[model samples]
Target: MYVVTGGEMHQIDRYTMDQLGLSEEILMENAGQAFVRHLLTSVSIDEKVIVLIGAGNNGGDGFVISRLLAEKGFQFEIWVVPPVERVKGTARFHMDIFKRCGYSFIEYEANSIGFRESLNTCSVIIDALLGTGVKGNLRKPYAYVIKAVNESEKRIISVDIPSGVPSSEGEAEVYGVIANETFTFQAPKLSAFVYPSALHFGEVHTLEIGIPKIAFTEVAPQRQLITEKRVRTTLAKRPADAHKGKAGRALIIGGTQEMTGAPVLTTDACLRAGAGLATMAIPACIHPIVTQKLTESTFMKLPDAEGEIRSDVLKEEISYIQYDGIAIGPGMGRNISKPIYEALRSFNGPVVIDADGLYHMSNELHRWCEEPRSGPTIITPHPGEMALLTGRTIKEVEEHRFEYTLDFAKKYQMYVVLKGPFTIVTTPVGEQWVNTTGNASLAKGGSGDVLTGMILALVLQQHSVIDAICNAVHIHGKLADKMIETHDIFSVKASDLIHSLPRVLRSYRY
Candidate 1:
């Protein structure tokens, strides 16, 4: 699904009203009615409900919901937070009609005892507060309301996004209503798929508010949700008589004597991701230990210098001729970055630069980022690595992840996988995909190693570099999501994801 920022969504809303001939009032009616329908199915009419109305068009939705609930014979309260006069435009029209229907509303005050009592008595709270217009932190009044509503511990159904949650990604750290469920109109806010705000939105139900597909414009939106359907379609189908050689050969090069497990985990995930042939290029000293842990995949014993692979070992033309894709940097340790760069500077194939591999690349930006490459390059970097590559503070990169990632990818002509919550996959051409799979369980060790291997394997199997990376990212996260269903997030380790790959991948294969 295409994701939109608040401003982009507003453009879509305006385009529908202006170009598609769906007026503001017509759209508001459709939105409110759609929300009400979902509301009826989710909560009982006999329950004591309260619709907290704000001052925007969101208030308009609340007023329509209030009128419909009253007509259904439900005893509900309409509590307007801002003064009734502050409501204007389409919302004011709805408020007038609701009052004409003989239903009065209570004027809610911050820290009001009456409001607190109403919250305590109500079973369901209809949060029509700030909606998508919220920017930065919440004001004192709305923050107070959000805190009180949260303390009430009532079943909260947010209108559109939860109040105080920014519709833009990476801006969800502000105070917001923690709703049990949220009924968003049209497309979901970009922030809905992104976290800490994702925590605020429980089960999100996107209700169409009469906006046609054409309203999103002739061109498809650049940012999108990496969905299961997209991943399923992008995945390659094995033939009836498939052979290992045709599946693709993946090379994982990294691992010092001290960090041997990182490369081992990468090899495990690469093979599990269905790479026909897998090879780990590790320091000769660690080969004995890695071979014991990894039995199925073969190994290349690179010459070791101080327990790390010397850069001169893999710089020859013959070294990478047999492999379709190469992944560097899991457990590569810190010292061999220059040698890593020398190897990267010579080779020409689909290469995944990860872990300390990126740490190495961070030093040679002029050589790697500025120079042209004969083949595709994929970099999987967490926020810290991304900051190192871009020379920005970690906070700056986190705050503007979309911008920084896209800019880096476009400028360097490479596929950029900025790993974190809601992992973003940005192509060299500016297209972006945000994967919603995976949980906090992935925050532990060895997660990125597994993801790095998965990317390399899928890129060799799938035709489109963009599709392959996105599918790998989605499945990697989806595996973690599945693990949390039967096991706790804390208990999930990197190896567990490798073990669960078949069950998760089986569901995707036709």
Candidate 2:
């Protein structure tokens, strides 16, 4: 689905009313009624609901919901946080109609007898005090209401995004309501998919209001939420009589004596990701250990210098290897970056630059921008590596993750896989995909190594560069999701992801 920011969503809302010829009131009515349907299925009508109403259309949605509940013989209390007169426009119309229907509200005051009494009486809380337009910290009566709702220990359902969660950029207020569920209208807010604020949105349900499909198409949000179906469709179908040579060859070049496991993990993931042939080239000193751990894949022991791969050894051995795709980094140490760059600078097939490989590229990004590669080069960088590449603080890159990644890819004419809780994959032209399948299970060490290998395997299979990156990212994260079903997140290590790849791929088989 198309992922939009708050302003973009507002434009879609406006276009629905103005261009599609749907009245604003009918749209509001549609939103409220649609939400009420979902609410009814999840909660019982016998429970008492306290609707926290504000001065905006979000509050108007609450009024409509309260009116519907009253009609259904469901007991509910409407508490207007701001003065009733502060409500205006389409919202005012809904409020006036609700009052005309003989429904009255209790004016909520901070720590007041009536407020405390309402909190004590209600079994459910409907948070409609703030919507997509929340800015800064929780303020005034909204703050007081959020505090009371949180303290109530009642099941909370937030209208659109949770109150105190900013729909725009930046972190959510720690005081935001932690709802049992969030029923969002139209598309989900960008914050709904990202962190800090995402923690506040419990079970998110997107309700389709009366917005025309054309509005969404016209707005054309560059961001998208990756789904399983998308990854499944992007994968290449192997023939019944397929041979090892036909599948594709993937080369993983990295590993010092100290960090030998990193490259082994990459090789393990490469073959598991469906590569026909996988090779791991590490320092000669570590070959004995890696050989024992990895039996199925071939190994190339580059000449060692101080227990690290010598740059000259890589240059000499690379000429002999005939691989379809290369994944460089993982544990390549700082010494071999020159040869890694030299190898990538001339090669034609898809190359995944990651780990220490990116550390070197950070120094030569200016050169890369001037003389771009003809073939695809995918860079997988966590926030720390990205900070080194862009010369920005880690916090700066984290705050504007999408924007910074898009800029880097566009400027250098390469695809960038910015790794995080929500992994963002962007092409040089500005199209982006955010994979929402991962959990905290992937935060452990060597996760990116496995991901690099997966991307290499897909790219070697001749999938489009963008398709390969997106599919690999989705599958990698999806494996983590599957792991957490039967195992704890803390116990899901990088090797576990490799072990689970077959299960993930089996579900996608036709």
Among residues 3 or more apart in sequence or in different chains, the pairs in candidate 1 whose N, CA or C atoms overlap within 3 Å are 438-477
Q: Candidate 1, which ten residues in sequence have the lowest lDDT sum?
A: 337-346
For model 2 the local lDDT of residue 442 reads: 93
- Indicate the residue-level lDDT of 203 in model 1: 84
What's each prediction's clash count? 1, 0
Candidate 2 segments exceeding 4 Å error: 109-112, 172-175, 314-316, 335-339
Per-residue lDDT of model 1, residues 1-510, tens digit only: 778888888888888777778899989888888988888886887899999999998889999989989988888999999877899999999999999999988888633667888898889999997868877767667788889999998899999888888888666265789999999888877877655667889988889888898987653578988989899887977777778888888889899988989999998999988899998888999998999998999988888789998766767522777778899899998875445556665566799999999998888777766675768989999999999999999887877888899999998888999999889999989999988888899999999999998998888885688888999999999999999999997899999999999889989995
Tell me the alpha-carbon RMSD of every candidate: 2.2, 2.0
> What TM-score does structure 1 among the candidates reach?
0.94
